[model samples]
Target: MSVQTEINLSQVVVRQSQKWQQLALGLLCMASISSPQYVWTLLTKPLLARLDVHLPVLQVTFSLLIIFQTFLSPLQGKLIDRFGAQRFIGIGTLLTGASWIGAAYSQSIWSLYLLYGVVGGLGTGIVYIGVVGQVMRWFPQQRGFAAGMVAAGYGMGAIITTLPIANSLASHGLTQTLVEFGVGFALVGWFASRGLRPAPNTDPIPSATLTTGRHYTPSKMLKHPLFWLLFFMMACMSTSGLMVTSQLAGFASEVGVSQVVIWGMAALPLAMSLDRLTNGLTRPLFGWVSDRIGRENTMFVAFALEAAAMTLWLTFRHDPLLFIVLSGVVFLGWGEIFSLFPATLTDTFGSQHATSNYGWLYMSQGVGSILGGPLAALLYQTSHGWVPVFSVAIGLDILTALLAVVILKPWRKRFLQH
Candidate 1:
């Protein structure tokens, strides 16, 4: 064999190794950012107590955390596309960890809002979009599964921390818990992010790839009807998940199970841990299914499953055992948006401007937060029951599931054919 042949083989092996290494690093970075959003419900009661703020006002801080994390994603996506993933992820992680530590020392409501709401939102948004986008670009051949694994980091990462956070808050107080976890998140995120790298995209894709064999810039992608279909579909489904996630503790308490022990564990914390695991698992599971059966097909199954879960949850919600079990199913059905939609977007639009294009798609999450968080909360208040809130979410899930086949499948085919 020629010496040059050996050199080429070595280079290929090294690049493959680095690609997987980068994936692992991205996963850890996402995990570090998970607590701010996923664990917010745990902090609300304490935050309200220390500040003596009303529920409606305290909920704003939570809403803004999601809003900033999502609404700002399009801009952050473009920035990641231009500036690269590692830098933004590193900086976002620092701010996210610091936001917690800062919130631990808040002297007033507004100060807490600024630290946990504004800073937390911006920081998580940057890292969330950056890591997922980077993964999609890196593993175009396995876009769905790759995006799922990274997203799973965000969803599942909290599982390891939920019980710990609850225990910490119970024993050490909220302030110490925040300070200690914040320091840990900061260090882990910083170290992991140092390994981040965007996969090279120099090779031309084949004409028969899942994409349209044409690329669209973020601006051009907006003009296509297919993008809007995806945007609305995502908004509808996102609303269902976010409503449940944001209000779990409240609803669990109303059902008289938040503090009830199930095998020596508080129902709410145990539920949170279960939900996180299912949420994390669903992303990759459905993403892998999408890679084989197609994105829209998997969406139909997952969305319909969530719709069924919501209805059952509402029916048996008064029963603590059913509530805990059904909540995990709901998450398993819902969390794949982080996987499916981005993969679909790249498949439909091409990956050249995937980060930027997906940014716009991600903004639907912000929209969902508004509808899911405050509006759903208001409906529960006015009706003085959870029926109305769950009813609305169930409707959205069903509609989105039907549209996945009835609308998205046909429209996408036409879009690609043309």
Candidate 2:
């Protein structure tokens, strides 16, 4: 072969290696920022104990974290796009770490709300959108799986820290645990950001993928009825999932299973760890399935699964063994929304403004956080039981599942045909 040809082949190989390396860095960034949301349940008991706050009042912190994480995503996405992913992600991670450190020293509930809730949410939001958007561009042919892989990192990252945080809460207390984990997340996420670059847009999409070749700006995308349908569907699913996520520990205690031990491990932490695993696994698993079976079909299956698991969970709330197993099942169904919605959105609107477009859809989670987090707690307080709360979640899950296949399938098909 000619030397020019040999050099061309070598450069291609290097590019392939760099793409995979970027994927790894994206995963690390996601995992590093995951703890704030996932581990909030574990911290609630400690925070309540330290601050002597009411349950409904304390739940606002959870809502604030999600609200900020999602509601500001459009702005964050714009900034990441204009300024570059690496610079913003590194700064975001540092802010995330600092939020935890500041929260550890907070002497009042309001202070915790600002530091842990607002600052942490902003930081995680930057990393989440930046990494997901970058990776989506990196592997256009395998968009579902690549997006799923990093989304899984966020879903599952807390598995590594759950038990450790639980132990530290038991031994060192909440203040110390937050400081240590904060430092670790900051360092790891910053290091990962340094290795990431924006994905170039020269790669072609395979003909098999049903993508709208037109790139729609966020404003145009918002005017379509189809976007509203997707927004509603996501908001419903988010409400159900975030309700369980933010309120699991409190709900477990209400059901008399919080203190139950299975296999020498506390049921809450054990169940939480398993839940994280399944939550992470479902993103990629369902994402890959959607690639073949179609996104709406996959959503129907996964959302239906969550509704079923939730029904059984409420039925057998007293069984600690079932509690641990079923929580994993619940998450297995719900977590795939992270993968499915983004892939579907990008497929429909095109990737030119994918991050910004998804930013609009992601705001649905903030709506869910409000309805599911503090408001749900207030509902529990007023209704004087958990049944009403769990039942509401079940209804929303079933509603969303039906919408996915029935309304979404036909509407999206017609929209894309144009």
RMSD (Å) per prediction:
1.5, 1.4
Over 64-154, each residue of candidate 1 has an lDDT whose tens digit, in order, gives: 8888988888889999999998899899999999999999999798998899999999998888889988888778688889999999999
Clashing pairs in 2: none
Off by over 4 Å in 2: 1-11
Q: How does candidate 1 fare on TM-score? A: 0.96
> What's the distance in Å from true for residue 312, model 2?
0.5
Q: Pairs clashing in candidate 1?
A: none
TM-score for candidate 2, residues paired by index: 0.97
User: lDDT scores for all predictions?
Assistant: 0.89, 0.90
List model 2 lDDT by residue over 1-418, tens digit each: 9999999999878878888999899999999999999999999888999999998888898899999999999999888878889999999899899999999999899999999999999999999988888877787766788889999999999999999999998999989999999999999999989999877665445444557468888999999888898999999999999989998998899898888989998888999999999999999999999888889999999999999999999999999999999999999999999999998988888888888888889999999999999989998899988899989999998999899999998888887776
